[model samples]
Target chain A: MKKALSVIMVVVVMFLASFTVVRSASAEEVKITGVITKIEMAADKKSAIAVLKDNKSGESVTITITDDLTLDKFKDHRIVDGDEIRTKFEKEGDKNISKMFKKTAGC
Target chain B: MSGKIITIMLGCALLTTTVQAKEHPGKEQILKDGYQGPKTCEVCHPGKAKEFLGTVHWKHASKADHVDNLNHKEEHGMKNRIYTMCNGNDIVNNLKEIPPNAAGKTKFSGCNTCHPGDHTIDVGSTGPEAEQSIDCLICHSTKYDFRKRKIVKDDKGNVVMTQDRSTEAAANIGRPSIKNCMVCHEAAGGGALVKRGFSMTKEADVHVSKGIICVDCHQAKNHKIPTGRDPNNWASDGIYMTCVGECHSEKPHKDAGINKHTAKIACQTCHIPRTGGAFSKDFTKWEKMSNGFYEPSTLKREVNETAPVYAWYNLTVSNTPHFIGPKGSRTDGKSKIYPFKLFQGKAYYNKKDGQLLSMDFAPPMATGDTLAGVASAAKILGIKDYEPVPGWQTIYFGSNHQVAPKGKALGCANCHSVNGVLNLKELGYSAKEVEKLTTPEIYFEKLLKLQQENE
Candidate 1:
């Protein structure tokens, strides 16, 4: 009975450990500051995808912004092309999914 | 009192002082320079003078024909509307008749309140100075100063504006600058902001900082600036202006939706965005009195957006500069979407029938009495039972100039959101008619989400 209980405890501990690994993978892994190059809205006009030129590498990365965030920004602060923005995002396969959006102080 | 003109004066004064400090040759050298007149200009550049004489600038100063322009009023039957402007003794000898209060108290004039006898190149002359001919330096001078000194009373109460053509003539002659054009054009309706709407304020010239000038797109050939405008909102197939598409070959946006949207919108519609920031300096409010005219009530330097004001436009209106208004619609193959300002006027209706007449003519600042101008217009148009409709002359004006840079352009929500700037019903679109228009691929991700949720 004790042997069986130890195995069950081990299995429970592994399941909890897997959740942390998954959370770590999805947490903000990339930090980049760049000027916005372009923004395109979905056909439903619900969300938008923005392309930003990475200030350090001169490479461009795409970030997905949800519609709620877009509406919030549109109502008050507008993020336009040529505006410098710093974003922390998670790498979701081939895509860079935005976790936070902040308009930075540079060009 | 002269709202837009004051702004023009203020703007020009600042700009002139800056350019002058850097470029002014010196008072002594200017006095020595021999810029006798247009005849002097004609000596070497006769071709230019001949071409210029045929243009509107030459005719803008001449008398009688100026009054005769109001002959349309007589043709329409309002003879009382025929009045003179600037016939003061302070004016030149050739005016043919003196004014009601010649060179005395402030008097009534036609459009000549600000369009007075050639403040541009006449130097200070109250009449056509130099030869009874055109002034070349006003347009051709690189360092032209068009500041007309106020005709103030001397110790002896005399009125004078130097009448010194030599001072302006001797400045420096070259291609005209944006400064030369904006001197008058900037203050069209006595203020920058309806009889004077649809203007490019000094703050709103997008290309000026980039070294672009007026004549670049509004190129002159034979002294005629071919603005390619067509009044009465005709098809835009043949008429052309360089504001967009022509000057910029490709569609400006990266998205296809915006590109497709351009078919029904003008570039200024998006570029100009909203009005009445630094671009608009005054709010003109006229109250309709029992006398069948509008009288000035609340006038303030409020740059906030005035809800309903259309631009006076095209060659059809004498006061406006040359411009092409939006001329096409989606039904027409020639439609290129253009944006416009929605202008409001005091409506005129029949007192008996209570039917609407026209609010075609709104008296500008120079017209002294707003009600009198409206009465004259009503009478001229043969509306005997006409009455003023308070606060209901909503009209549309095509947006021009005042183009904002890309960074400052309107956001998509300005026109695309649930409660956007435009009304879908007014535009002939039902809610369902404008539903999602994407291809099947747009639903691919959403479908996956649905599947995941079901799991």
Candidate 2:
């Protein structure tokens, strides 16, 4: 019984350690500061696409946001066009999925 | 001692302003405590009020650059100029004076509903009060509710436009978006999707589909937005918008024949194929309704994906006595074939002077008394001995928006056949030229040869 309990404890620790590694990998998310040119809300209201003109390069970066927190900000007009934004997104497939979206004008 | 006192006063004023600016709370504080109006914004964006006050949006009039219809020195914009849509006389006649009530509210109706101000001022007026009269949040605040922009009567029985001055709206302030501009522009004929069918919707415009907004092209410089001129539109800042030089190349088409056609055809002539709304005012005739109020008896004409009437336009308007149309012909080298939406209607005119009378029909629509509205308009206009007579009027609006995709452009057979849309003879083409252009076989042979050469 003691040997069996020792094996189970080691297995649980290994699983938690792997989870921590996966969480840290998300730090590879790219950051961009730009002025939002357009924000198109999805018909379902579950997602939105924001086209931002990069402040440095002037190229437009399209980011798809599915997070409810950011979607509520758009719906409530806390975030809007011509606003300077600091965003962090991860490129998944052909889409850039937003992890963080915020206004440079404080909260 | 007086000189020392003056210097001390100036120092205190400067110190006070600096202290206020430094102590100004951030957005978080504004959201929690609620918005405090323009004074709170001025603490950060100084001099913006004065700058905005000088714009045409505030003055409702500006320097005329290309108005050929009226005398430039005498008549300018909304003050003196008239339109087929509504003469705008109601707002002009009822302009509230400067220094509004303690609440900064004024009589708002007609044009004042769209005009941005708490009270009206003189043409060249200035000062702190004038700056305060300017409504910055109307354009800047994303949370600004346009539906709340209603024309209602005050407790004193004076009609006033209600404004959305909610603190919730103030909490979300930013630069004006297309949504702000459309609040007035899209509802020009007093309803949604009515007059001025703007190409801002995804279904109506390719640019919008590609995520293009109005400011991307019509970039407002110092609050002066660049606008294309039209007949009855006199206000101008001398700036113009072009597609080729600004966004597209002069020769955008790959086909040599198609590229050559650009010499005599405007881009909009082919690009914008159709324009109008379900409730677009095609022809309006004010008639007495069963309810006794004078309302428009309209013959609703919708475009509904149809061909637009073609005309040659050289950027000049034919402003004859009681007549207006695009001043261009096929003979003019500088002119190009353009599409226009022809709006026709009946209006009250002076029988003796043969001048079209500007009427404020909004009051009559409610009171059911047509003569009273006319009399009030005439009094404000300083006209003597007016006799109203119904007369026919027409206006040619250029079809400039709702651009179809490039793949849907007019093809060779669309204009080069015998049963083609273009009437060659009516377009000022000579007999021989008409024959040559109408022959589809000859045009196709040439097109085939061009294709073979490319191969």
Candidate 3:
């Protein structure tokens, strides 16, 4: 019984250390400004994939937006093709998940 | 009572200025250290400096994919291209010196006066040194005095123009507004209301009356402002700003009959019936000089409130230096009827190779030797030989701004009549189609009869 308790304590510490590493990895956020070249809404209308052409580098970046506000904008056509947008996103696995998706404010 | 009120007003103004200064603590350090140029700003906003360096404004060149005559592999822009405004002169060279005979405020400074660089000589250089050459205050500071820019000798003894570097302007910084953009745009093609003919008065544009601004439509990302296929400046990535999907619905008109025209007619066609501001340059005829060079004749026509000529544009722009216009036809499926301000001028072209000669008529306009100018231009372009001849040309400036109110748009009778503004034959329509388009009375009568029968 004493041996089993010691093993359980070791497992709990390992699990907490792994959780801390994951938290640190997800903390890095990137911001970009670009024009939306294309948008693909999910069949369920809960998420979307937006391809933006970076204003400076002229490189294309794909970001997934699952926020309710941005999803409603896509449905109403307020944020459509050719509209310039400024966004903040974080890398999760192989995909970029949008943290903040908004049109580039002007004037 | 008046004396007390004056004191109170002064106190309030000072307090407001102090509060504004406190809001931007980073700028306060600039005031403390004095204006040390772009390097100071780069310390805090390094990302902005890097991003701005890659912009078209900094490089003065980009890929001209929107140009119909250009191959996709080549890169071109305002710096390298010979355009209508100063066609015969070398633009890169002209950035250094304002010709002795330059007109108006340009006499004091060269093209570099409007450029957002510390010195004319450092306009297109790269790396950390080039990053330091950017004059951030000119666009960002409201207090930056435009009059302070003057022609001065650089450390290398090169004649270059420089701008104000006062700590006051450095302390006050913000995003660019319409006022900042107008300082240069209003002065294009020499002086106010000369080139584009855009006016910011409420009467000029309904959008302005409703508190809209230039940047609202010309949205920018990392300083890359998307543009229409203006031959003077083409989009590198073929990205263009559109009104249909952006600010308005694809079909905005309430009437189906009117909405049907949206397929082939652009909004500017009926919306902007007239363009050009007060004293806009309409035509410039260059006459042959005794010295074998051509100079602009005194007989120039300036028009105001001019009617725009209609044309079919399909997003592709002509790259020809002599005559840059939109390339499209009524038969093309993507073509749409658009409005254009046709500016007529005269210049010399090569009779042998059919190349337009860059007329060297900058300073000493009286002795503009066409042959010498041609040789200089040819050397820069790597051309071997040419036979120069005088010729006429026209540049089409798209009518995209100074939009009128919805009610002020063109009426049906404006273009659907025998003596209307639109010329059906010139628009590349079939003879039968022309007759049908010009005779709208028949359609009106048929509609009236149908309505009477229903009643």
The candidate maximizing lDDT is: 3
The global Cα lDDT (0 to 1) of model 2 is 0.64
lDDT of 1 by residue, B71-112 (tens): 332221111211111101112211111122222323222232
What value does the lDDT take at residue B40 in candidate 3? 79
* CAPRI band for model 1: incorrect
Q: For chain B alone, what TM-score does every candidate structure achieve against the true structure? A: 0.58, 0.80, 0.80
Question: What number of backbone clashes does candidate 2 have, counting pairs of residues 3 or more apart or in separate chains?
Answer: 0
Worst 10 residues of 3 chain B by lDDT: B100-109
Q: Rank the candidates by DockQ, best first.
A: 2, 1, 3
Q: Which stretches of candidate 1 lie over 4 Å from their true place?
A: A1-107, B1-33, B58-104, B107-109, B113-131, B142-164, B194-203, B228-240, B245-247, B254-257, B277-329, B347-392, B437-455
Which structure among the candidates has the greatest DockQ?
2
Ranking the candidates on TM-score from highest down gives: 2, 3, 1
lDDT of 2 by residue, B1-455 (tens): 13443454455445434542342245666667666555667777777778876676666677664545566665366655565555444244343322222243322235445666543433435788767655666776767765455456566755544456667677666546566666556545533344444436666787655455566667778777777655445565556676664456678776777789888888887787776742222113455432233445554333334466777878888764456667778777878888776665566678888777776654555554556656767877788898988777777766777777776666677788888777778778898998888787757787687589989
Candidate 3: stretches off by over 4 Å: A1-107, B1-25, B89-92, B98-112, B235-238, B277-304, B320-322, B363-372, B379-384, B440-455
| Better candidate number, 1 or 2, judged by DockQ | 2
